[model samples]
Target: MGIVGYFLPMLICAAIPVQSLSRNAETALCQTQEMQGLCALSGKWRNQLQSEITITCKKGTIQGLYDSTVGNGAYDLVGKYLQVNETDYIVGWSVAYKNQHRDARSTASWTGVFYAAEDIIKTQWIRAAFKNPEDYWSTFTTNQDTFSRVQSHPCLHNNRN
Candidate 1:
């Protein structure tokens, strides 16, 4: 099977919401020690694609805004740390994409996951263009990106060209 065919099912499955865990179970899974390091991943990360992603953790959820060669957008991510075997994953939906006009531009619903480690987030995203509802599933393109945390510089905040 081709790449799209191979990942289509997985993408569909990822979209399905999993059952919520109980308070005690959640506490056991998302330990304070494990989650502590996740805070360090909240800062700015520069990806191989030269995109800058700024992530913030709030109430067990991650909010991210990214500026890249393609475009600028924001996503709301939610996930958990499975302390049993030491693995963390975050899934997010692209909430909005801003165009050159600084207006809200509607794009494909981006659904992806970030596999997290010490200071890195391995991202695999499938962008499906849905201009035609009937053929949306066949229009997906995948991107595998790696992002590493970097110390922020004052000049980086300036958007001047």
Candidate 2:
């Protein structure tokens, strides 16, 4: 006779369908092969250098800007997004900017995959400094970087270091 007793049964029955619809809709819009789900990557990301990147995705193309806290300033980035194995979110992009901190001209390119579970992008990048062509050995350097999504509002359990 209580409302809780009556509504519990109805709520339980409704839960399955609501969950199914949500799952189905996510699959339809988030498929990587169709480039529909790149929107998931749209947001602000912070790199280890404290550099910030704001990215937007449409179709298979990515348009974004990289703001270097340590470098010159802000630079436009061009890149492509792909869905591999229909489950993995893959991305590659390049940016050319002057590194005022290093007093050098350089172009850096990154190839990485977005980890949805962790909301992070791990990348390996090769930065080439423009200098004497013969100084090729010292011109290029490689390193791995992790970019974490910058939350607009911190989570209750946000423990990012």
Best by TM-score: 2
TM-score of 1: 0.49
Candidate 2 C-alpha lDDT tens digits along 1-161 = 68455333322222222234355453443342322333556556899889877665545666667887767667767688886654457988888884343454788889999887788999999999887878877988899889998841111112111
lDDT of 1 by residue, 20-133 (tens): 445554344334332332333344667787876655443344444566656644333333322223344454435345555454334433334444456566666665454577
List residue ranges in candidate 2 displaced over 4 A. Answer: 1-38, 85-87, 98-104, 151-161
Which residue runs does candidate 1 get wrong by more than 4 Å? Answer: 1-38, 72-95, 99-118, 133-138, 152-161
RMSD of each: 14.7, 15.6
Clashing pairs in 1: none
Top lDDT hit: 2
